[model samples]
Target: MTLTVAAVAIGLMVGSVTPLAFAHLAENTPEERLGRTMGNAELGREVGDAGGPLAVGAIAAATSLPVALTALAAAGLASGVLGRVALRDDGRVRPANPPG
Candidate 1:
């Protein structure tokens, strides 16, 4: 049960983090929003491109295939987290709560 919960928890953690980090790629940016939107888009793709393989291989090496797959998924979650970090708001490209 613990392992099962751990698996689910890990899954949920990855599930939540992935989109938070990388949803910007799938966002629709208008012409004016290009500059700001691209920051996240580029970040999402780049991070995914750079990290995906390393994560898979590293996990595979450290553990078994199944664990490695989990790591790969975790990497995806990380990407999502990273992507969302720089996400721009719609309508104005700038967030309503711009940090002071």
Candidate 2:
């Protein structure tokens, strides 16, 4: 029961994060390369979506489930930091237009 709840929570988190990342990519990308960038991004996302659980399972098998989850959390934090740095505003993304 606890594990089920945790799984649901994690699923929610991943669901939100992935779309937000894609939206950020879309908003920041050049119009000419948007399709290609989105395609590549989706491909990478699919790979990660499939591979992430497998990697966590492998880590759990090698060590323990708690340790594997801890490692995943650490990786998430590190990636968040990297993403913030990479996406830092240098005025590259177009400014949002005022809605009429």
Looking at model 2, report the run of 10 residues with the lowest lDDT sum.
Answer: 91-100
Expressed as tens digits, the lDDT of each residue in 1-100 for candidate 2 is 7556656766776778888999998987767778998999899889878988998899999998777776776766687789889878787645454233
Tens-digit lDDT track of model 1 for 1-100: 7557656776686566556544433344455656777676668667866886687778778887678766655655675567556564455655533454
RMSD of each: 7.2, 5.3
Give model 1's TM-score versus the native structure. 0.42
Q: Give the number of the best model, judged by TM-score.
A: 2
The local distance difference test score of each candidate is: 0.62, 0.79
What is the TM-score of each predicted model, taking all chains together?
Answer: 0.42, 0.77
Candidate 1: residue 57 Cα off by (Å) = 0.5
